[model samples]
Target: MLRKIESKNMGSSNLGWLRSKFHFSFAEYYNPDNINFGVLRVINDDLIQSNTGFDTHPHRDMEIVSYVIDGELTHGDSMGNKNTITRGHVQYMSAGTGVYHSEHNLGEDTARLLQIWIYPDKKGYEPNYGDYRFNWKDRENKWLHMVSSKDGDAPIKINQDVNIYSLELRKGEEISFPVKEGRQAYLVQIEGNSLINEIELNERDGMEIVEEDILIKGKETSHILILEMSKED
Candidate 1:
């Protein structure tokens, strides 16, 4: 099963300096029937104006990942770690018991990012934070393995049985992904346009796939994020 969600159909919030599209029920967007997909809880597509961003915030027991799409995103947390993540970079945080963090765009241009939240398999683990700067060329015309529970070539680690991939494709390029039994996936188009199994998706569009393999073809230069995981009961 493949369900395509148009970019404009998702709930959105515009707070002047900060604008966001929530893929699941978040903040003020509540849809009980659309709360989550498998263990994937939230996917927030955000654009932060220059020199402005989210102030100190609290989170607990959630596996958080942020992927910078454009400009730069500066991050600071109560754990005393601070870093600026640029395009093609990823930040991961395990808010086991609790943690406080702030995200800001100090650059001259607007910053775009996708903030994702996934449920942890078990609670009360140690809180931590980390990031990886991925080479753009690695994902060009193919899948770049970003995050995973396995320990081989994945750049980041999370506390869930999930695999995350990043793809940068030229026009007319195609890629195939297999969905094994009892597994599902969620995909987000970050830039340009593409077709997934013949279903058109524009920038910011999202799709949920279950129990079926997927073939993605780029209609134009496209950047995509994919999250695959075991189906939740």
Candidate 2:
């Protein structure tokens, strides 16, 4: 089954300095029926204006992943890690026991990022943080394996039964992804537009695929991210 969700239907907020679109029930946009997709809990599309960003915040028992789409995202955490990452870069933080972090856009242009939260396999893990500045050409017209479970071979490891793949497919390019039995996947159209199995999706749109293989054709130069995990059956 393929379920498409329009970008407009998702929860959104704009506080002048910060603009966000919440993929699942979060903060001031709670939806009891739309809480989550399996263990994948949240996907927040955020755009922070220049010279502003999120201040120190607390999180615990959640695996967080932030993917930068444009501009610069500066990150600071209690673990003594402070770094600024740009387009195509990713940051991972396992707020197992607890942690405090801040995300700021210190550049001139507005910074855009997708902040994702997934429930960890189990709680009370040692808080840790890591990130990867991926090469821009690596995902061109192909899938780039970014994050995976501890047993999987991705550069970034997290405490979950999930795998994340990214693609910067050129216009007219076609690709295929297989969702095996007993597993499901969530596709995030971060930029551009595309048609997945003939279902049209514009920028910021999302889809849920359950145990089905999908063929994607780029309607435009598309930036796509897919997270595959065990089915919630």
Candidate 3:
């Protein structure tokens, strides 16, 4: 089954320094019926103004992954890790026991990113942080697997039974993904326009796929992100 979620219908917040669209209950966007999708907790499409960002905040028992879409995002965490990443890059933080971190857009322009949160298989694991600077051409018209369990081959490992992939499809090109039995996935139309399994999706749109397969065609050069996990909520 496939369900398309238009961007216009999603919950949104507009602070002067940070504008965000919430895919799940977050901050002021609370909905008891829409708390999460499986273990996927949150996906916040955020735009941070220059020289401003989130101050140090604490988190625990959550696997956080931030995907940089444009401009630059600088990260500093309690683990003594500090780094800056730009478009097409990924930053990961596993807040097991607990951790504090800050995200800022210190660049000259606004920064766009997807802040994703997933529940771990079990709690009390060790906290960690990592980032990847991927090659743009790797995801050009192809799926670039980026995140997975520790046993999997993705560059970044998370404490969950999940797999994450990305693609930057050229205009008019086609691609496909399989959501195997007992598994589900969420697809984000991050940039540009796309038609997936006959559903038209514009920028910032999302789709939920369960125990099925999907074929995506680019109406324009589209940047896409997908997170696949077990079917159980």
lDDT of 2 by residue, 1-233 (tens): 99999999999998999999999998899999999999999999999999999999999999999999999999999999999999999999999999999999999999999999999999999999999999989999999999999999999999999999999999999999999999999999999999999999999999999999999999999999999999997
Query: Which structure among the candidates has the greatest lDDT?
Result: 2
What lDDT is reached at residue 112 by model 2?
Answer: 94
Give stretches of model 1 more than 4 Å off: 150-153
Enumerate residue pairs that collide in model 2: none
RMSD (CA, Å), each prediction = 1.0, 0.6, 0.7
The model with the greater lDDT, 1 or 2, is 2
TM-score of each candidate?
0.98, 0.99, 0.99
- What TM-score does candidate 2 get on C-alpha atoms? 0.99
Q: lDDT of model 2 at residue 2? A: 99
How many steric overlaps are in each model, in order? 0, 0, 0
Give the CA lDDT, 0 to 100, for residue 16 in model 3. Answer: 96
lDDT of 3 at 90: 98
* Residue runs of model 3 more than 4 Å from their true location after superposition: none
Query: Which of 1 and 3 is the better model by TM-score?
Result: 3
